[model samples]
Target chain A: MRALLIRDLRLAMRAGGGFGLGLAFFLIVVVLVPFAVGPDTSALAVIAPGILWLGALLSCLLSLDRILALDWEDGSLDLLATSPLPLEAVMGVKAVVHWLTTGVPLVLAAPVLGILLNLPSQGIIWIMLSLGLGTPALSIIGVFGAALTVGFKRGGLLLSLLVMPLYVPTLIFGAEVARRGSQGMAVETPFVMLAGITAGSLALMPIACAAVVRVNLR
Target chain B: MKQETMDTLLSVHELSVARGGLSILCDVSFDLFPGQALVLRGRNGIGKTTLLRCLAGLQPVLNGTIDVGADAIAYASHADGIKSMLSVAENLRFWAQVFGTTDIETALVAFDLVALRDRMAGTLSAGQKRRLSLARLVVSGRPIWALDEPTVSLDQASCLLFAQAVQTHLDAAGAAIIATHIDLGVNGQVLQLDPYAATSNTGVPSGFDEAFL
Candidate 1:
């Protein structure tokens, strides 16, 4: 398990078309939001949470296919299926690696990306906090999606279609908390709910992902 | 001295696999022993790959459990199982890490892929990719190898390389079940199947091609 984690992290870091592409995609998403919504600070502040959440959500969507596709293509998935490591541990290691390479950097950079959208300084902390708590759920859920489409030829579009609906609640609650926190409204309920969603998904998604991977690989 | 010469490393009993109302393999039984190899020979649309898939546990058995005993195993099919986007070394490193091994460089050398070590697997020619995938098994060093057409894209030299590797593996008392059309030098036990032997509920096409539904 330790080896799996270390290896996945190294692959994500060393592999081309990963972090740099993900970062560029995230930047493009953040930069494009104000153009669509207009440059009004009030509008930007009001939508900052939504924009950040949406950007985070889409960026995660772009990378979710990475979860198992590489392993599946490389035949490592078969070795893993036969190995002593239970499939659940394999999915867990994958999720942890995804979170580390994709989720952490996105969280760290959210506030800066928020600035490009003219988001208020007060909301910066909330955006970072909500994303930190929320993006792990995205990675976890994304694994299940990736697993379901792991063997399909045109799985990228299929994966998005399958997992986007599932990601709705997280997007809503994450944006709600960030928006409320930015607006100086009472933000406790939404924050707790988002955390609950994150925890629940983290607890359940890896098992689900493993099952889907088994089905797809077969 | 009673029954001390059982060569089988894998034993299958009454195995059947079905998918979505289509029965693929039925009541197929076979045994594969150490220091021996089995060739699952059949025509296209026959259950050759499906049977291999079933044995690898990639596909579930509807009616049987394969007894593989307590030994390590590796499977490589025509899927080229290596990720195309990764460099040869990165690909090897990934599998080595996953399979809990550290001798990836030596495996690459054995497969003669050391020169292409830094090249992305996606760019390699068919034979090179095939060789790289085979190298993964070298790093795995498992007791059992379930390979489906491991020579699909290999030139004569690489095929010889693969044949030598399989011989070396079996010489170490390991077992292999290869599903291929061409022979692999070693005298292999043939498990030939006639896809037309499948009997349908209607009972009219037991041996007829039109009854192949």
Candidate 2:
């Protein structure tokens, strides 16, 4: 599993397609928001949390296909299934690596993107906090979507259709935490809910994903 | 000694294979012992690949049973499990690590990938990639190999290299089952899959969804 993580990270760095594209796209979306909404600082501040959450969500979506498709296409998936490592653990590692490359960067970049939207100085940390708490859920959910469409050549549309509905709770609770915290309101409930969803998905999705991958390989 | 030798490395009894709830091969049985290889010969779409997958534990058997000793098996199929961006050495190293062994130099020489070890996998020719894929079996350290059309795009030289690699593995008390259209150019028993094909099989296909309900 450690080797799987190292190899995947190395591939992401050397391949150059997955590591920074989502970050760049996140930057573009955050930059473009000011233009679309005009230059009102207060307006930007009020919408900043929502816009940041949306950008992070879409950016996470951009790299969703990266986790499993390449391995499946190259036959690494078959080798992995047959390896000493169980398929569930393999899916778990893939999700963790995906989170490292995609989710962690999005969290680090969120505060900067938050500033670009004229977000209040106080709100920046909350956006970072919510994104950090929420992005793992995105990756776990993304792995399931990838498993469902592992066999399809063009799985993007179908993947979106399958996983988008599941993203609702995370998005709602994540946006609420950042939005409420930015306004100096009580964020305790939503923050806990967001963490709960991530914890639950982390515990369960790999098993579900492993079953799906096994079925797809069949 | 003869009685002990008859225990077999692998045994399949009246096994049936399926895909997506449809029966593909029925009542197929075979046995493989150490230092032996079984070549599965048949035309396209004859469930040869499926049978190899079943033996490797990648897919479930539809009926009957397969018995393999505690020694783990390695599977090589599905294109070249090669990552084009990583160097040839990195690719082998990854599999070696996954298989819990660090012995890569032998695999590198076995398939002639030692010279290309530093080169990016993307730059290698089709035959070279095939060589790299076959080389993974060596680094894997598994006792049994279930290979599906492993020599797909290899040149004669690479084919001989692969045959030698398999020979070395067998000589070390390993066993293998190969599904291929071309001759492995090695000594092994032949298990013809045509006899077990499902199209000629009748009696409502005999399991779970026997008749589409």
Candidate 3:
């Protein structure tokens, strides 16, 4: 499992691996919001938390197909399936690595991008916190979607279509947490809900992903 | 009979396999012993690859039984499973690590990939890539090898090298089942798949409405 993780990270970092593409997409979305919504500071501040959460969610979506599609394309998934490591472990490692490479960076970059949207002073940390907690669920769920669609040609759009609906709970709870925190409202409920979703998906989704991957391999 | 049963590495009895819901090979049976190789011979699309995949546990068998230990087999399909971004050495090391083996030196030397070890896999020629893919079998350290069309892009010399590798494996009490056309000069029994070909049309329905047919 460690070897699979290391290989995936290396693959992502290599040229044409789509390593920084998600982060760049996140940056573009954050930067474009102020222009699209006009330069009204109060208006931007009102929507900053929601916009940031949506940006992070969409960025996570951008790389979902890559989690297993590369391995599936090169037949590494088939070989890995026959290895000593179980497919469940492989899916778990893929989710962790995806979070590390894509999710962690987006979480860290959220605060910096928050400034561009005139985010309220208090909301910065909460937005970052919500994203940090929410993106794991995104990665895990996205991997499931990747596994489900790995066998199809031009699966990217279908992957997005499949994963976006699953992202709703995390997005709603996450954006709500950020929004409430920014307004100095009670945040414990939504924050806990977001964390619960992340924890639950992290626990259960890898098995589902592995099962679907086996079917796809067949 | 007792000695043969004790030495048998893999045994398939009345195995039937399908692809995309179409039965391809039926009532196929074979037994493999240590220090032996079985070459599967058939025309194209005769279900050789599907049979190998079934033996390797990559896909489920449609019918019958394949008796082999779960972790004792290693499969090498046509895809090579090579990551283009990593170097040849890196590719071998990754598999070695996954299979929990420490010796990649032998594999690199065996495949004559030591010179190309540092070069990224994407940069290698087709034959070189095929060699690297075969090297993975050595790193795998599994006793039973299930290979499908493993010599697609190899030259005469490389084919001989592969045959030698199989010979060495057999000598070391390992076994292999290969699906190939050209003879690699290795002394192995041939299993012709034509006799087991399914008589029914096992392909996808001609049209959506053909479901009734």
Q: Which has the greatest lDDT? A: 3
lDDT of 1 by residue, B8-106 (tens): 678887777654335666778877777888888888767777777777777766666677765356888777776666789988887787677888987
Tens-place lDDT digits, model 2, residues B1-213: 122236588888898887656678989988788899899998787888888888888777777778876546898885788999999999999999988999999999988887899999999999999998888999999988989888888889888999999999999989988988888788999988888888744343345443222
Q: In order, what DockQ does each candidate have?
A: 0.36, 0.61, 0.60
Q: Write the per-residue lDDT of candidate 2 for residues A40-96, one digit (tens) a residue.
A: 999999999999888888887888887899988988898888888889999998889
All candidates in order of TM-score, best leading: 3, 2, 1
lDDT (C-alpha) at residue B135 in model 2: 88
Q: What lDDT does each candidate get?
A: 0.80, 0.87, 0.90
Worst 10 residues of 2 chain B by lDDT: B204-213
Which 10 consecutive residues of model 3 chain A have the lowest summed lDDT? A209-218
What is the DockQ of the complex in model 2?
Answer: 0.61
The model with the greatest TM-score is 3
State the lDDT of candidate 1 residue by residue for A1-218, as single tens digits.
88778767766666474865566688888888888888787888777788888888898899988778777765668778876678998998888888888888889888888888778888889889999999999988988899888977768999999999999999999999899988888889999999999999989988888877776675
Return the clash pairs for model 3, or none: none
> TM-score of each candidate?
0.87, 0.95, 0.96
State the iRMSD of every prediction, in order shown.
4.7, 3.2, 3.8
Clashing pairs in 1: A74-B81, A74-B82, A74-B83, A75-B81, B7-B33, B8-B33, B9-B32, B9-B33
